[model samples]
Structure formats: C-alpha cells, structure tokens
Target chain A: MHRQFSLQPFSRHYSHSTHPFLDFLDFDGSEPTSAGEPSAAAHIVVRPAERAQLLDVLAAYKDAQNAGTLLTLTFVTVNDYLWLLRAVSQELSQLGRSCLYYLAAAVSDFFLPRQRMSEHKIQSGKGSLHIEMDQVPKILKPLVAEWTREGYIVSFKLETDEALLVPKARQALARYGHQVVIGNDLHRRKFEVVFVSPKASAPRADQGESVPGEHYEESWLRIDLEQHPQKEIEEDIVSELVKRHQAWIAAASAASA
Target chain B: MHRQFSLQPFSRHYSHSTHPFLDFLDFDGSEPTSAGEPSAAAHIVVRPAERAQLLDVLAAYKDAQNAGTLLTLTFVTVNDYLWLLRAVSQELSQLGRSCLYYLAAAVSDFFLPRQRMSEHKIQSGKGSLHIEMDQVPKILKPLVAEWTREGYIVSFKLETDEALLVPKARQALARYGHQVVIGNDLHRRKFEVVFVSPKASAPRADQGESVPGEHYEESWLRIDLEQHPQKEIEEDIVSELVKRHQAWIAAASAASA
Candidate 1:
C-alpha cells in the first residue's frame, strides 16, 4: 500500500521509520559512490542520504493507510511562462491535479531574470554558474498541446502573439484540437481572458449569445478545484470534451450517417 | 523543430491539428504489443503529441531557424524510479550544475479503465474514463541515489509521513549526509519550509547540528524566495554535495599528485 503526502508551510507532517520516502536531498555529498561518474550539480539539491529510511517511512505509512495523514505539496511556475493576454486559463490549469517541472521552468517571454540564485554568491569566492540567457518558449504550449493530443480534453494555453494572437491561438485549436484555447493578453493578470474551443469558437450557452456572439468572455476567475476535492475536474474536463467532441462526432457521424 | 508545448486537453487538443500532441499519456497501452516489445503505460498524458513537436520546436529555437514562432513550457515531477531517476541524473548531472526538479505538474499513477473508454458513452450515456491509480516509485529518489551511487552528489525530496511539522528535518543531514533539505509543507499555499543543513556541533553556519535545534524557532520566520531569491536557503545544499564530490576529486588529484 502506497500513500502520498506533501509538506506544506505552517504545517506539521510525519514520516514512519518504514515508509517509502526513504531519502532526502543531501547538501553533503558524503554518500558512497562508484568512480567515473560526475559530481552532483549545485543548483538542484536534496538533503540527507538513506533513501531506504524514507522508503521505510513511506512503506509503513502505506501499511497503516491513513488518508488524513496523507498530504502533498505540488508546485507550479507562476507568470513566468505568461504567453497569453489573460490569466483565467492558468488558474484553471493550475487548479487541476498538477505537478511542476522545475528544471524546465521557463522564464517569461518578456520578463526579467535577476539571477536571484546567485545574485550575492556570484561576488563571493564560492564561485558561480552564471550565464547569459534568452527567452524560452511559453511553458504552457507543450503542456496544453500534449494534453489535448492525449485525448484528455484539457485546455491549451495561448498567450496572444500580439501580432497573431487570435489567429495563432485559433490555429492551435485548429491544429492541435485543444479542447479550449485559453487566450489571454500578455499584459493582463488575475485570470482575465477568453476561453476558446478548438474550432475557433466558444462553448455555446443557451443564454442567447450573451454578447451577440458565441464567444462570451468570462472575466478573470479562479477555479478552486481543490477546495471541493470530492468534485472531479477530470470529469468536468471530460464532459466538456465530450460535449465539444459531439460536434466533431456529429460531423463525423453525419458524414457517414 | 522540437517545441515543448503544453499538452492540450485530451480531446479538443486532437480535434483539429494533426500536428498537435497525440498522447502525452500514450506512452502506455501502445508501449508494445510488438513481439518481445517492452511494456509501457499510457497514463502520463502531458505531451505525447508534442514529443515530436518538442523536438521540432527545440531544433528551431536552438538554431534560431524558425521564422514563424517558438513556444516553450516546462513541467517537473519527482519519483524514485531507478531508470527514470538515473536518466534525470544523466541529463543534468553537470559540475556546479544543480538539477532542480520542481515538483509540479500532474501525472498520475493510474490509467483509465479501458472498459470505461470503450463503453464509456454506452454504459453511462456519458462517456467517461475511470482511472485506476496506483503508486509508482518516485521520479527523484532514483536519480539522487544514482548520483550518489555514481560518485556524483545529488539532492532529493522527502514527502514525509507528515508534511507540516517534521522533527526529522533537522537530523536529515547527519543521517543521510545531506548538504541541505528543503522542508516543504504541502498544505501551505505556497512553498514554505526551511533549508536545513547539518550545522556543526559548534554551530557553524551550514555545518551545524543535523536536526533542527531550538535556534530554528527564529528560522521559521516568513521569508519569500521571490523577494530575496539569493540567500540560498539550501545555500550549502550544493556546497555540501560539492564538498564530498570535491573531496573525491581531491583524493584523485592526490593520487595523481
């Protein structure tokens, strides 16, 4: 039996002696090792050594199988990969079951990098790993497109290329078939943006074209999926996908019907 | 040519773009029905479709060859899978290069029930996939251990049996020889924890006692990395690992000396 838990700030967590989380990042590299391998990098570090210790801790916890004792900490890069005109999509994306990839955490397309990691240390004799950098791709693009391709019916993010914002976003859906292309302004924040379905259209609401057009704007809003943990965002996304998929299904069905 | 775009929501992402990510999670079922094919589970549905797209985008961006545009996004997760962890260590195991695997993004340890996928609409009238999740070895443990096993120092994470208040945070260094441990409380809205290192018995900075002592009462103060991203909480995390690594190097140098 395996249990999952995360340590939150202002929180108290426990580990068993026989649990699975048997290791911590060791700042000290005193552990034994074979020759020819390189030394660990300085940027990413964990502490402690005996992974088996943590593993034993987790193993025991799993045996006990207590959900209350099970907690988790997930991370996300905020605003650094803002390639959109709004932020709502990000809120939604962040709301679902998420994990973060730190190594790939992209710097914002037009943002600043203060070298915060080594700002002070750079001047010290300790040495530094500084280098000039350039803007990387908006991180959301890969996630959005990949999720869509997996038939997860997740959302694709679009930071409107000011020159080709709508066109590019719309094409993403057209090309990737993203369930909803969340288009946001590069400058806007706090979840303001248009949620676009892949067909270059918006989800139809019987409210009779609230704006005389199918695409209705839902201003920046936060999606609290975790607050209502019992509620399934996965299904919500799936239901939405199925609804949108019906059109494709219908067109496909009709063509053969 | 290899662009690391976000995986679009499952269904919509695939609606239009044939060029879009197909199945970030497709790594599964399709792994191999081939004769003697290795096994796979198509669950981690993040960027399956964009795997190739990522290559394309990366190629374009790396060479500055793309005339149209380039998009990038990054996601990270931690696991103890030996092979995967080893791969991570292999990928970013550079000298003075710290590999930070931010624990963000969602890739569950489950796959949807195939019946749910096949008879989804017919059985429920609403097509839905029931994901059966199980625990897999973490993605980070293996790498850190491998780094150590390979003679390279590496850091790791410990999602404790308890996340909030960890008594083990302090002793982590001495027990495991960790340079530092970034204690994270999962419940905290943002990452909140202490960068714990083995303070020397004499209370030397970064090399003091392994377990968090009374001095840490003041250590739990509110400090934001953004405001001051410099003061490496895990400041010695890298250094500690490096020291051991350097020691080995020094040992080698002495032999050469």
Candidate 2:
C-alpha cells in the first residue's frame, strides 16, 4: 500500500481595517527610482507577514487561475510564499496528483528585515546564519508520488544547501518520482539557473531541445479581477485549464512505463 | 451671451470596469428550482433590449422630482427600484446652504446582452417598441453650469451619437453653466465616462416646490463611476459624490425648485 500526503485547506479573513503582516511587497523585478526621492511604488509593496496576505495572494492567484493564467504564483513574504507552495502542492495531491515543484523558502530568509533593509549600503557584520529551520510540509514529495500513482508528471524548485545540485535533484527523483527539479544559487533578481531531471544522467538526450518557459504579461495580469465584469476573463481561465490538462495527460502517459 | 455647456477639462486616464454587474449577479439569484435540480447561479444577467422593461417605469415619474431621499444623489436609471436614488445635483450646486441634490447620467443605455427575457403580460396593444431609444443623459444641464464655469458639476452620456444628454440637460434647465459632463454609453466597458463641465446658471429667485418623483439606484451612474472595484448593492451614488466634494446641496433640487 502506498502512503500519501493529506492537506487541509486554510483561508485567512482580514477585518475591515487591518491587513496581514505577511502582506509586505517584494522589490525584485521592480524598477528602482532615482536617488533622493521617495521610492516609486510600481510593483513595490511590503512583504506580507500575516495570514491575510496569504489569503490575498491566494485570492489573486485563484482569480487568475480561474481566468486562465499558466504563470507561476509570485508573492512578497518568504514564509507565506513557502506556505503557499505547500498549499498548492497539497491541493494538487488532494486532487490525486502529486506536485514535483520547487519552493526556495531559505531564499527569503537571507534578506534582512525591512527595518534593517538598506539598498545603498550592504549590512556589515558579514554574519552567517545558524538557522534552526523547522520542518515544512515537503508537499513536493507526496505530490510527485500522487502524480505517479495516477500516472502524471510534475516538477519543483530547489536551492543548494548541499554539495551538488545534480545529485540532490537525482536523490529527489529516486525518492519522490519527479521528472525534474530546477536548482539555483538562491540570489535575488539574477538570470543564472540550472535544470535537473531524471534524464540528466543521459547526456546524449535532447538536452538543448528544452523550450524556454513562457512569460506572462505583467500589466495584463496586474488587474484587480474584482473590478472587471465577469465574462471575458473567466472564459480565458477555463480555456487554459482544459488545454493544460489535455497536454499533461498526453505527455505523462506516453513517457510512463 | 448665446452660450452652450462648458467643455470638460481633460484629465489623466481612468479605468472604470465596474464589477457591480458581476457582483450583483443573481445569475440564478432566484432558484426556479425543481426536485433534484441543481442550485441556481448566484448571478443575474439582463440584456440591452430587456432594459425597456425597466425604463418604462422610470419615465412615469420624470416630472415628480423631490423623492425626499435622506441620501444626497440618485444613482438611478429609469425604472430603478425606489430605494437607490442618488441626488446628483446635491454634490455640484447649492444656494449658499441648500444642496441641489439630483442625479446625472454616467449611465449605460445598452446593458449586457441577455440570454432569456421575461414575457410582457401587458393589457395593451403592440406596446412593443423597436426602441432605438437614445438614453437621455440625466442632469446634464445644471451639473455642467455652476460647477463648470465657476465651479461646475454636471454629467452626460454619449453614444456614436456622442451625447445630446448634456446639451439637452442644459437646455432643460435654461442654463449651461455646469462644470462637468460625464460622457459615456457604448464602445467601452469601463473608463468611458468623462466629467464634463459647462458655464454658470443665471440665479433664480422665488423658487417653488415641485411634486415628488420616485427614485431608484442609479445603475447607470454607478456604471462608469462607482462600477469600479465592483458595485455595491447598498450604496447610493449621489451621497457618495457629495462626500468627495463638500457641497451642501438639496436632496432633489430640480423637483423642488
């Protein structure tokens, strides 16, 4: 008998006036302003710290998902983003498909708190973190297993706390049955990346044949879905879901033993 | 001087995709249910042609103006329910201490296309009209006069017919000195409304009270302005604008004047 990951759904309801702490925004991908002026708030919000932020991001993502966006979900707070990663994984598992997706939580942990954040000058202490990271739900593991059980495919993210990214990715494949796991150095706003898949052991494979990830239109997706009438956007989301499911089913069955 | 309504000042771009149509949906608000039937949708959609059913009622009370709503404006369209009037005049004009609370149009003549409309059980003849009814822009006259030239406030809705609402509204009041004209009706879903203003109105004395007119929610006014972020079922449009502009206006000036 195969074991599985069980996920419980949670929603954070904010009061009329208060906002969740975890709702702070991220400066990454944001255009910085000229010196000696207030920072421009173009995609620049504080990282979210409370439960409400998670719900807000979830609501935004849900609205987008329902509206047919294939974009990866983005958030400000490291903790909430991590939590969301697990949530998405658990949701996928509950639907009888395991997720093999990457979540770089330790990434945000490196950033200093907002009160201590200074853009111009780097913080001095050059201190190393002796972090006591608690156990996060390894949603990716169970998700990938669930997908395998139902004959599906999935992928995830990884950042090196270990010696080699390739070995780490292979270990993940052996344990969770993920076809691929993207590994990285966990730095901010950089373009360098690495992809690790079960097929990585085969060099003669169609390694260069991988297509680039498609990017989403920021301004278009940046809308407050609640502000627009329901039809056009809603129909778009439905069409995207159907398309993805059909493609995923085809790809997984053909590749599976 | 043989003058017309003052032209509205051009301003920054505005996006007003009022979600009220979606939010107030009873898609199946009422469950015309049968045994073992599925739940009716919580949304309601009415089409452009069907709006004639609602307009028939509003035209009945056109002359009776002072509905005495405690609220300031009338966010009403023709045949709007008695509860949602927004005394639009109250926001732009006043005689020192009195508010000319009335409504103007930023309303839609054509509504969302409908699927099924109710059959008319009228005890009348070809009471049906192939109505090419151009929705008259409500309150275009007075709102444009005082607010536009001196401190204008008026509104209008334009079609490919651009709007005759403002000019017609101004002529109705025997003055064109309004500051703003809300122009909109078709060709755009949101942000189509423009605030147009015309010159001042000549002062009148010995004003007499007019009989009461029925009122309702100005879905049309809310369409371009309040429809953004979404439409609230309980909010009155006139009072909302007053809070934004500090005018001590009447509840319905034209009816009582």
Candidate 3:
C-alpha cells in the first residue's frame, strides 16, 4: 500500500512567501512575466545559478511523473479546515490507508459564527467596532480520537517565547497521544524544530525513573543555511521522517511474521 | 501643494491581490521564476503577447519616474497601521499638503496586548487555547479632528452583508463629518461601490423629496469587466476622487483671492 500519507499546507492563502516550494518563485529581477492576460510586468530575468536550479527541479518533476508516482496537492482555506479534516479522515479509513496529518496552518483562535455575524457591514460611524467572537471548539481531541486512528499524525506547536516550546510540545504529545509533535518558536520556526515523540527516551534519564513507562523524548533538528541560503530545512526533515517510517514499517512486518 | 493626499491599503499583508498599481505585477505563467536561489521549478515561461505587455509596463514605470513624480509606497502591517497613520498625518500637515485619506484595509477589531501575552509558547496539555483580546481603541476621531484637519478624508465601508452597506456608509459620513465614504460589499467590492457624500444630489429625484435637508447623496459605480478581467476598478476610483479634489482646491483658491 502506498504510505497513504501526504503533506498539505493549510493556510488562508494558497501561495505564500515562506512556502519552501513557492519561495523559489519570489524572483528579484528588473522585469516580471505573466502567463495569461498579463496585467503586471511579466519579464523573467534570473541569474545563471537560479536558472540551473529551476531546470534541475523541472527534470526531477518529469522523472517522478514518468515513474508513475502520484503527487496529490490539496489546498485548504481557513474557513474550511475543520470540516475538511473530518472528511479526509473518513476517506483515508475507507481506503484502509494510514494517514499522516501535518497541522501547520495559522487558524483563528476565535471566530464570529455565521449566525451571529451582522447581516450587513458593521457601521464604523457608531465610533468603535466591538466584535465579540466565540471561542472555536478545540478540534485536536476529536481529530485524534475519532479520525485517522492507526495512522501516524504530526502537529506543530508554535510560540513566540522559546522557553515554552519544549514544555508545550511535550504537553501536546501527552494529551493527544499522536505520533509526533514539532515544537518551534515563531521567529525561528524556519530554521529549527524539536520533534517530540512518546516512544523516545527522556533526555534526562533520572527524571522519569519513578514514572513507570512515561518518558518524554525530544530530537532537535536545526539547519544553518547562512552559507547556502537556497538549501531548505525540509530536505533534512523529510529524510529523518523517512528513516523513522521505514524502521517502523520493518518492525511491524517482523512482528507480523 | 501636491494634493498632499495618499491612499493607504491597511491589512496584515501590505501587498495583496488588489492594490491597483500593484496589480501590474500579478503575472500569469506556467513556470515560476526566481531572481536568485531558485528552489522549485521557477522558469519564466510566457507567450509573446505577455512579453509585449511587460515591456509596456516597464516603459510606463520609466516614464513616471523620469517625470519627477513622487510615487510613495507606504506598507503598513497589522501592528503598525495606527502609528503609521499618525505619522503620515503629521508629515502631510508639516508640508501643508491637502491629503485624501482612503482607508481600505481589513483591520483586526481586537488584539492581545503585548504585556499580557505569554513569555513562551502556551502549553497545549492544559487543554483549549483561550485568548482574550482587548478591543482596539478607536483612532478615527483623532485622525480626522486633530491630526489631519485640513485634508479631505474619504473612508471605506466594507460589509459582507449587502443590506448594511449604504446605511453604514452614510452614518460614517455624517458622524465623522468627513468628505465621503464609499460603501461596498465584500464579495462585489472590486466591481461595485456606492459613493456617499454630503454634496452630491440624490440618486433618483423622488427618493429623497420628502426629507427637508435629509436628502441622501449617493452615486453608484459598477463596472462589468467580464471580458477584461485584468481591468482594475481603481482606475475609476482615482479619476473620480481627483475631480472632486480639484473642485475643492478651486473653491479654496477663490475664497482666498
């Protein structure tokens, strides 16, 4: 069975500046280029190295397609994320495929439900715009318990303060019992992430000695791309994840045999 | 005095899909192109017609810049809109510029105070992320009355519900005593807008005949760009606003003379 896991970026906008793949598209040249109905300056000018890199990428894509590998890309908007997640879970279960859900979208913590929202635009002439939004029901618990069980799951914990990253990540791991929780700081998220897993051994051996089988595991993955800014952290992240998944698959097969 | 007015697009992300002049940069093509460090398949591929359109844009930009015209591009982020507005007001006042403030940004109604936020990431194990944001203090009053008094301020009223557009727009015009308020629905904002002002006559004769001086002055502008989707609504907006401002200037000059 195809690993049945896919990587999807769920955010308000389909294309963003920080997206690893799209980041390459943010060209800095004297001219701009347009594909159809050119409105803006559509001139494409790139340095030699950048052109070579793009050609390499196109070649790789061609190779993958020719090999008959499926590349499924799904775009999720903020308004539809909750409903879409449930639907995806049900679909994956029916197909008997283990899924890996990567939660990376910056969702609104609270929102004005459709029914409570004003029928017309709120008037600014009244002086101040006082909007009281209801807290969105927490979706993680239900997501873990009800959908995509027997599948691996990965979620992100992002905070402005670096000190709170590990503690919060571990807490999420314990609470959700998911496969992995990546903890990162907002400012440094692009460069670093600490993977938290329940199966990992405690960094400090003596700390969890009396806690029965409860041992928090943490693995730090950092990439300094100062010299090579074009290099992405995803390269390392994907490689590490693949290794872990392969090991897990081997162990499962051995047990079954 | 350079008409001393500026149109600011206030949103979390400054450069978006709709800033009229910025629209020229939104090109369409099969492949993406990067100026440097191309990561994904960013090849600049476009048809011959698109190339001609881009050259036209470059020529226009060169002409404007060579003519010694000042085209200020002020980008304001979510956290900085208020401060930037104040700063712009002071700058224009000092220069004795008659400014036109066109406020058309999707601003957040509430925000978490910096002091109240957690030093580190909030732990997820505690269950449920409850964020209590304080209502943003209304700054439009001081903006009009104190900061930019000699300027012509035209604000925008965007509502999701069509019914609330006109009432709210008129209320803002009366309440603030500003020059004008353009009312638009979120979905059709690009193509349709109702300009509400104290000077203009009622749209239809009998609609406001009963009211003594309470006659509503509203002008509906709707452009159907079905065949020419690339055509922007801002072109008309700028032209109309320029006509009104010129008349205002002539009146001011006659009074002094």
lDDT of 1 by residue, B1-257 (tens): 11123332222223212322211212234454354222332122224334443433333333332253322233333232334445555756664333333332434333333343542111111222233333443443444444633333333234433432345455544344534455555444243555554433424334434434653321332446688864544444445445655665666568778
Tens digit per residue, CA lDDT, model 3, B192-248 = 888878754434222322323355578888888897687778789878998887787
Superposition error at B7 for model 2 (Å): 23
RMSD of 1: 24.2
Residue-by-residue lDDT tens digits, candidate 1, A1-257:
01112222111122211111112222234432354222332111223343333333333343334345533323333332243312323444553422212121222333224553342212111222233333433444455444222232434343434444454445544444334554555554232445555223554222222323234223233335447644533344435445555665456557777
lDDT of 3 by residue, A130-190 (tens): 4555666667767767776656667888788787787767766666666678888789877
Which stretch of 10 consecutive residues in model 2 chain A shows the poorest summed lDDT?
Answer: A1-10
Q: For candidate 1, what is the total of clashing residue pairs?
A: 167
Q: Scoring model 1 with DockQ, what do you get?
A: 0.02
User: Between prediction 2 and prediction 3, which has the larger DockQ?
Assistant: 3
Model 3, runs deviating above 4 Å: A1-79, A93-100, A106-113, A123-146, A160-164, A200-214, A225-231, B1-44, B48-79, B94-99, B108-140, B160-167, B200-216, B225-231
Per-prediction count of colliding residue pairs? 167, 95, 13
Runs of candidate 2 exceeding 4 Å displacement: A1-257, B1-105, B109-152, B157-257
For each prediction in turn, the share of the native Cα contacts (below 8 Å between chains A and B) that it retains comes to: 0.00, 0.00, 0.15
Query: Which rank order by lDDT, best down to worst?
Result: 3, 1, 2
**What tens digits encode model 2's per-residue C-alpha lDDT throughout A25-67?**
2333544456422233322223334324343444444455457
- For residues B1-257, what per-residue lDDT tens digits would candidate 2 score against the true structure? 00111111110010011111111111234564463232333222333433332223222222122243222122233434112222333433344333332333333333212232323211112222221233333333433434322332434434444444334333333333333334454554253343333222323211211211111012234354554555431244445455534532332344468
